[model samples]
Target: MRKLVMVSMLIGLGVLPACTRTTNTMGYIVDEVLVAEVKPGIDNRASVEKALGKPSIAGQWDDKTWYYVSRNTKQTAFLMPKPTEQSIIAVSFDAKGNVASVNRRGLEQVANVDPVNDKTPTLGRETGVLEDLFGNIGRFGSAGSAGGPPQ
Candidate 1:
């Protein structure tokens, strides 16, 4: 009985780790006070960078906008991570390099996208396995033909 109880306790201890959830923070770590201090017109690229650090991503089309993204996710063993909190701060700069606008967004902007089927549908003639193997057999050429052995 004592041996059985010891084995059970060992098994329980091993399984405890798998039952616990893991939390992960991805992208820039946001500091609310610093973010709040960044003011439009007063703060410029250099000040913003000093306060908030470098941005997570810059504007794709132009260098006028900077984005700071943060996300917190919780995941279980062998399971996909689920976002619990998300924040995005977009700072737009004017031609003079001063901050033009500062915008903050939350989890409401997050979108769930589902991909299509695994096999991508392509534009072409569909052939069977046998057709693929023997398709080129006869097409090679016959005697005296361009592709055939010379007579």
Candidate 2:
């Protein structure tokens, strides 16, 4: 009787994990939403709003840009364990508010860009960490300073 009860309990416990195991869907659905509804060369502010829905991001620089984005995400495991599906629709307007460019960006074609490009000059910096932190390599020679004679 003891052996049978112990076997049954172990079997029941084994089944519990299978029942509880679930996958966290870490992705969003980007349906067939209108990418750029504004007319490529004729649409103005009012015309653009009439064609497409409200933009996810909209502002003006030298030119005006409207961005429409959709995403579905799931984070099932540790940091950045799941995947995401996303889309970005961008529309640009000329100074006169005529649509200049309409571009579609999918997950595979997009790249994250840093606002400031930190580039090293060709002259190059000092090699060693100590040299970079403590002035030039010749600084060590000036240790016995005050214009004193060398040892």
lDDT of 2 by residue, 30-134 (tens): 344444345588777667666675677786544388877766455533444233566677778888888888787867754565555585446755467766687
In candidate 2, stretches whose alpha carbon ends up further than 4 angstroms from where it belongs are 1-33, 59-63, 77-81, 109-151
Query: What are the Cα lDDT values of the candidates?
Result: 0.94, 0.63
lDDT of 1 by residue, 1-151 (tens): 9999999999999999997899999999989999999999899999999999889999999989999999999999889888999999999999999999999998998888776886677899998999988888877789998999889
Return the top candidate by lDDT: 1
Ten residues in sequence with the least summed lDDT for candidate 1: 113-122
lDDT of 2 at 30: 31
Score candidate 2 by lDDT. Answer: 0.63
Give each model's clash number.
Answer: 0, 6
